[model samples]
Target: MDSDEDTFDNDNVDSGNVSSGDDDFAMEVDISSSRERQTEPEEYHYEVLTTDQIVQDMVDSISDVNGVVNLPRTITRILLNHFKWDKEKLMEKYFDGNEDKFFQDAHVVNPFNKPNTISVPKVTKSTTDEICEICFSRNPSGMMTGLECGHRFCKQCWGEYLTTKIMEEGVGQSISCAAHGCDILVDDVTVTKLVPDAKVRVKYQHLITNSFVECNRLLRWCPSADCTYAIKVSYVDARPVVCKCGHTFCFDCGENWHDPVQCRLLKKWLKKCDDDSETSNWIAANTKECPKCNVTIEKDGGCNHMVCKNQNCKHDFCWVCLGSWEPHGSSWYNCNRYDEDEARAARDAQEKLRSSLSRYLHYYNRYMNHMQSLKFENKLYASVKHKMEEMQQHNMSWIEVQFLKKAVDILCQCRQTLMCTYVFAYYLKKNNQSMIFEDNQKDLETATEKLSEYLERDITSENLADIKQKVQDKYRYCEKRRKVLLDHVHEGYEKDWWDYTE
Candidate 1:
């Protein structure tokens, strides 16, 4: 299960013509060519498979293969693992009727002539009993089974070996033959038959089920703490694929769904945020250097006249320009404005330093603004929620005030989305399309503010019903507006609609 094959390569699917429909939201691209669009709600649009469902799907896939070619399920699992669990490709490659290569490649001894059995190498044995390789017993008690690799061990020893591999060693489905240096996979046949412990067998099957999800590059375990769901999406569109678990994430980066900004920029932005670059940069910018020893010196509010603290280098220099302060003698604040040309690299480094800091600040400020606003809006929501409970004492149900809760939730989501958009926009190469996106972002921000205000209002006010209704309307408006902005950017990315400066 090589991951390189799972990388989202943009396939040459036909980019259908964009159709313009009844557009009212900010910067709407008309998908008119969609031709009689059906109202497919977002909730029902995708599939979410639990562990059981995923395992059942694999079973069904194997069953489909078995129907055409009567291979044992043990052989089938091997083939599936070999083909990275892609059944269609496996069938296409295997089912050309020249099947010896398939069996050989999968290392299944072809029993084509004697159809019902695996063809292991013939071994001379006494009519009495055989010696087990693992336990080195003379078949004293139980049954003995031989693998295709012709390694035979007593059933008890085999169970312990498989159990150790599955449970203690955590080998998953790839437990190998007991023969030393042999990589031949001990199939599920041997595992289930020889592994007599129900617990160990269950663990083996559980690990195999999880392996199919983990080893295959196309699937991901849901990041939710208690979630056991997996999502399947087109490999070509490796953007935000939402799970039914309500956890939307970038299939590309495995982080929470970051639209507009590509995974690379998101990684860079996050690393920049996490590090001390900003703090260190501020320090570096403010601190003066002792030119002799090149040591940093912070100003504690004095005249620009300064001396190097190092005893060896009693170099007197202007704190501002790092030039000799001999001309000014005692007090010289004007030295702070000293301007002189330096090396080319230093000048370029200074320019780049400023540019990087400014760029980061631009994105960070907007990100923080919407985030702070969302925090305040959430507080307001909690307050109003308390009011709803208080009103419940006056005979109002939680259902009756759920609209307030929903409005606040939508507001928060929209603002957070709007916050992330600024980071995306900051990296966006300025073009007509991005400019249009910015306009949409601005409009969404405006609508989100209005929604936040409505959600934050007092229940003590007159026309509570009207206020709630307005809040609902604003919620709908903000959500739709946010979707449009994101959807447009997503489309732009998918269709190569914009350029990036970075």
Candidate 2:
């Protein structure tokens, strides 16, 4: 009889394609026929074994040859011998497996490893009482089928298990298959196949993709063992991550370019970039340079007169104020302070007011003297007094009052020339003590009352003129007082009693 190795090799032969030229063709055919006699139907094989025939054959061969002596049987015997036989006790023992075998391949190894072959633990339909790994609940909905590890669990339990594992531990990381003693990672492809619902499959795929994406895209936590948090990419260029342990790095220094803590020394260095012009230029070249001192000045406004901040060479004219370290060379002018045209215009206006007021005062005094000389008659005197009272009520100045008195006197002179006899007779009758005197006195009294009422109650054009002149005089006086105070202060007499009183 052929040995098992030859039978296995013959079983693997491709029957459809035959190499006719080979001299060993007859032997190959005979071996193939014998292997075919030993083989069972494909359906029966599949039903009795795992999807992979090689794994099924290996398991069958190991079980047949070792009986109670192989690694699997030894693990089962060890579990039974070490613990009291109960469902929970058996599960706990089975789940832990043999420590030596479990930890033989364990270490902080790289995640990228070749596919591992796992020995399926001996689990029975009766031993399927383990709670769902996710919810830790005993109520499972359907029969459990594991990916490759013969670790069977309820379908609902397995799904929840995968979801929790993916969400918490993340993909590509190894997790024990839900079946006890079956230490196999539920990798991306296995997760996709086991999770049958369309939505769940998609979610698992997304999670797996996101895991790789996050490894590349997310900011890395500072590798400094004590640092806890990660920094984002946006804060990389200017403000770098600083650690409490005094380690500082630029935004792009680390693999993730993320630092949570800011460095005190790095912050100081960044601040120097703001203060030192050369340092600022090194960081960002577009900063404006002051023409006067050649130091960098940050441009805040639109004007071209760049002021240097260097104290020794702070020489730049403000185009707006025309004030700078050096004079404007007589070309630039500030009308408010030293413009000749405005100064001349202001002087001419002041001189005109002074000359006009002087002439007005002279004319006003002459008219007043003339009025005083003719104003002895009671009726005429009453008229002049009434006009004066009206001017005083309107807050008119003495000069303005004199002007009004002159205007009234001119009117009176015109009336006297037009009707001199009527005026003289009226005046004489008012003075005489006869029968006609009472009538003339009554007429004079009536005329005096009407004129007094007009003067006291009404605002005539002459009254308005006097009011305007008084206002102008008050304004001029106030201006003069202000100028005197300013002059006194400028001359170092600010603390004098007169200066305080003024």
Candidate 3:
């Protein structure tokens, strides 16, 4: 019969729907029915049989059902199957019946779980001619295999078989043992030990290790019948897969699989799943996309005139207000909707005389102060120069004359005071304060012209004494007038003719 037909036949027998005598007999002899048959004798049997006797009876029964050749094997298998006794303790108890050499040769200890060991029927060198059970090939050295019936095979052949199984059926899937009539599930750990170098091994190990972490929930292997690889879902909300084989991938990783790298599939999946509703809402509320490049951006403070970083299109927009280049007048400051005419009119209105009067006054006072400081510096320079000239005329040594001239030159180049005067004057003009000095412009021009001429003349050794006296007299007069002007500007002093006395 075909496998499907056989499976259907077995299902009929299992479900007790079949009416054959053999099927009825099989059901009657099954474990559940046997329990009913043994119930009446169970208490009496327990009373007569000691614990050891009961165990021996069980061993004998198993041996009778199988064969005498499998007596010890049946006993061991029965004990192991029934009670979860430590393998080591079971070995110790059972090996007592065998010779010391037999015990030593047959027993194997479990290293990881100590005190757990088992014994196999010793295969003497003479009996070691058995062929490798897996590939039915010659058993090579270093090969090891596990059997559901507790048999072992050559390590080399076992490795090859395991590799084939993993490369074929993969880990965590079903595969029968090499031994006929043995059906045990091969776990991933066994497969890993079998073919440590398989391509899937690394991925399997990663899945095993990371599976416990909640973040790795999306990591899964291809469930397709023939595929051996695993896939990771890049985004939990989106089911983006790399392969056209319908494998799911993480949203981020899935995007890489697209032709132009668009995450349309992932986006659709996310919308369907709605897995990131909270996160999406939060991001939408707090973040904005660049109007030009479509990149997500976060806004800090200030008016939301956002400039795009894309070189191709540097579109600026208000993030908070969602106003575009139109409102901002093509500039960040100009919101797309801002009325340029209205803004200009408002600015012009503010530029009227009264609005700027306070700024003009502030700069005017600053300019007067700066001029006073410049005058003081100039007076100091003139005094030093005069003193140097007088000392040079007294027939001072060359070193002394040089030192005086150096000091005078340094004072003359102390242009910080002059720079301050020029800056203040610029501010006065900028702020409309220069109008205050317009009336005296000609007098100031004449004073500057005279000062320039006086500064150009050199004081020689012969006329140094006379030049010194004349410069000192002029500096004193200039100092007194500058002090009066400064005090008048700062203190609102009466500007009478006596205040300007020479």
Best by TM-score: 1
Tens digits of per-residue lDDT for model 2, 5-29: 2111213322112223223322233
| Tens digit per residue, CA lDDT, model 3, 1-502 | 0011110011111111122222322222222322322232222121122222323433343344334222234223323332232344444555566543332232322112233112243443645444555555544333445633355676665566666665565432334455565444333445545655645454333332222121233334333333333343323433233322332233344332221112443344334335555455446555667755778777777755688777776887666444464645434555333465654443344345333444434534554554564456445445545655666568865455443333222222222223223332332322232343332332333333334344445756677656545444443443343333333333322342122101
* Candidate 1, 43-105: lDDT as tens digits: 223356766577766677677887876777767777888888887888998867777787667
Worst 10 residues of 2 by lDDT: 42-51
Candidate number with greatest lDDT: 1
Total colliding residue pairs, candidate 3: 21
Instruction: lDDT for model 1, please.
Output: 0.66
Error of 3 at 455 (Å): 6.0
Cα TM-score of candidate 3 = 0.20
Clashes of 2: 3
